[model samples]
Target chain A: MTADLLQQTIWLAAVLFAIGFIGLMVRRNMLFMLLSLELMLNAAALLFICGGAVWGQADGQVMFIIVLTVAGAEVAVGLGLLIQLQRRCKSLDIDRLSKMGETE
Target chain B: MSSDSLLSLLPLICISVTIMILMLQIVLVPGDRLSYWLTVIGVVATLWATFFITPLLPQQATILLTVDAEARLFSQILVICTLLLLPFCHRIPTARGSSAEYLLLLLLTLLGALVLASASHMAALVIGVELISLSLVVMIAYPFAPQYSTALETGIKYLLLSGVASAVLLFGAGLTYIGLGALEFSAISQAFTDIDLMEQGLVLSGLMMVIAAIGFKLSLAPFHLWTADLYQGAPLLSATVLATLAKAAMALALFRFYLAADLAVLQVINLGIALLAILSMLTGNLLALFQRDLRRIMAGSSIAHFGYLMVLLVAISTLHSVEGAAQSRALLAWVIYLVTYLAATLAVFSVMLHIAPASEAFHQTQLKGLCQRHPLSGWVLLLAMLSLAGIPLTAGFIGKFYIFTEAVNGTLWGLLLTLIAASAIGLFYYLKVVLMLISPAEGAEADPVTGRWLTRLPIILIALFIVFVGIYPPSLIDLLSQL
Candidate 1:
């Protein structure tokens, strides 16, 4: 039963990771992209934990702590920059912020 | 965490002290002037510690972080970069934020890069990368003014893209651990040996994912869309940090990982990296051909150089089966290329630091008559361009010469031809800029040199160093072969 549970968790993590990866690419909204990034990060964290559980080792969980810390840092700065972006562009679409590319 | 092991981390500890004291000062008294000098002192102390204490390093500083000779060398480069950027660090003219906070973040970023330079395990890699990148996001967006929206916009783009990059890196790392049951780099060779490459597809896929992620960070082509935007948008000093320190640390980390992993069997990996090299060379040079913005042009030039670096990387991997002077030469080629690239980049960016006005809109035409206006800086930029173009009597030429020799040794003829063509395209734009600097402008006012001696000295000294190294590269070669 525990083996089935671990397998199920791994499958779920993979699904979420795919969803996040796709959403990050497909979404035009900046906020959605940030959310997708978070989703991907948490998915990795979930995989690390389950992988550790299967191996009966603690390194996976140890890695998760670092992942969590990184996630928090990213969110803190990402949102701050998001607010700044909103103020400047007055919109959340990434398409509008494409003025930086080389102009021929 | 023993006393002896603690001794090995003195440099890290010194930087941490710098961070703590800066934080305390910010809490007790915002806009503290003393923090600037404190940050400088901290970087110097860390350099001294890295130089003096690393020789007596403990056998292990833990599984996560260990001070190896390679790490020590990269650390020396990082500290020296920080030392050179100190003159600019003192005066950060911002809209709302204080320079104190800026200095704190700068030092923190350096600390993270130092960890990356020496990280032996996966955790330190993630942590160090995150720390450096997060600080960068804030530092890019820190100087918020009503007029300058480009910085904010670019910061958001970098934040989102870099965030996704970190997640990808983490996921890849996690998958690798699942396959190998170990996260330490030392375990890579053992895993490659034990597992059948065709069957354990997870391990290979996972490693490839990690490579892709790093390529994003390093701004390799196809993943390099953000390089020009970020370089053009960030403050000159911040751009310098991104171009020089962050990329060097990532390249060194990749070098260590590539050296450790078994790559002789994997033909696909080498070809893939070579393709990226070719793409980067084409994209970087072609994009720069049309750019009127000086910052954007440098951005493109950096991309081309990264492509050149990748050729050396492929050479190293192709020659991985051997363990002799050939192997060392491959490594030496990449390091020499990296070193000369950094020096030339620093010279260019430092000149930009003085030339670009408060609004940060850098037009190529503004460089006209710079030689007549501010002869010292104009000449420095001129020399920097020559070196960057790999022209004769420049450090870049020697670096490229060594790279060409190694490419032949590895027999990467296709990449060699591509690199040669890129350098040809590279020379045109580089000369265009040089011509812009020396020639007189139509109606522009005379832009005099305004910065103090502290900043000017480094730019001139670095330009001179480029020339010196170009003339006598044997010394550097001898030193590299010793390494």
Candidate 2:
């Protein structure tokens, strides 16, 4: 809650976000990419909560909750699409999912 | 915060409640016709109510939403666009009996656009964007047909990329909040005066991240990889929504963000947007040149249009602090250009949707001697292409002319010249489509479908609007300048 703690929390969040961004780039699998996205969102939420505690305002907390809900909905819809894609292509490899283009 | 402010949010509240009630009614007694009619009625009623709600002139609906006159005008545009396209939704052939859920998702997307258009705080902006993109994901894959495998693929691509982009935007917003200690635009503008942007590296980088995310959404070049693929894959009506509602909402939101921001690093932002505009125009036109598919062609041309809009943004920026005459005049030109682009998009897509409801793509070769088979549809398309090409006596020409003048007056010589050259290249591809429709095919087999008059009606009406506006644009331009 002190200024030092707040700066550290932000530094931690920034590091976490960098890791997620790296994971998203390095991973080719669809599921891991999505999880990386979640990691990034969580980092954002951490920053919001830390900022709210420091500023003594509820707006940041409210934003965190909304981001959480959005992440859930995105995952749900994402998994549904992935499942359908898996059924057709018989694999989860990103390279294998390129059948949407004109194959002829 | 005040009761009066809450009262001013009547239109947005109406849309939210309508979505909820529609959800409840569906669970109680589900019927597609009933749901569709309910949505139609809801959107119309909200559109009507938007006008009647007497604001405190321009009141803050809450800490997040601002009920300003510009917001009202933009809300009117979005609502009217939805109402115009609802008929297309009704006509879009979905599997099985119940597409009530489709109606729900569409309404939710509208709600998102409504929220986004009025967002004055970072939290509201984040929520509004997530709402729009999430709801749009469901709608994009709504067809769920075996052959529409591309639709599902596009859905997955959109989900992942859009999620990442939103996360990026949210992270930037969080950084901004930490730097400024408040989420409201007013707070940020106030902080801009006290804080030296050169010293506040965190705030500068945060603003950059936010702009990058917006550039991704706008599909400006270098960040526009997924546009052609998504446009090619999504269903026609959904594509129309993406091209018009989603693009317009994101553009206006970015416009408002810039409007509210009193940044010291103003040149960096302008240079960034201006460079993006130039890149989009060059890259978009070059990509469209050899493409034979209609959807991809439309997608590519839209990037060029995005570039043109970006030019106007620069014009607006230079004119922002000037007396009312120039600044408002720039905004009016931008809005009229948007309206014309919407007309061209709707007119083109209506015909395409009706002609190829189930087909994946409309090839250039497929339309050989289309004029002979269906004159109404043919002329509808011809007019669309002509307008899109900014040919004389069409809405696009006047729109482009106004924007070009704004650019010259603003002394954006580099951007202005780039626009002129890109538009010349644009005319090539646009004409290819028009010529494909008009030229008689050798040994051509007559096409079978003439389409319903109901389908032809929208095309004709929109095309007529294009011609009407082209000839008498001053009235509308005058009206927009008043905003």
* Each candidate's DockQ: 0.56, 0.69
Alpha-carbon deviation at B6 in model 1, angstroms: 2.1
**For each model, chain A TM-score?**
0.85, 0.90
Best by TM-score: 2
Q: TM-scores for all candidates?
A: 0.94, 0.95
Per-residue lDDT over B70-136 for candidate 2, one digit per residue giving the tens place of the 0 to 100 score: 8888888889888877877774467765777888888888888888788888877887788788888
The DockQ score of candidate 2 comes to 0.69
Model 2 lDDT at residue B22: 94
Q: How much lDDT does candidate 1 score?
A: 0.82
| Candidate 2 residue-wise lDDT, A51-80, digit = tens | 788778988898889879878988898888
With a 3 Å backbone cut-off (N, CA, C), the pairs that clash in candidate 2 are: none
- Docking outcome class, model 1: medium
* lDDT (CA) per prediction: 0.82, 0.82
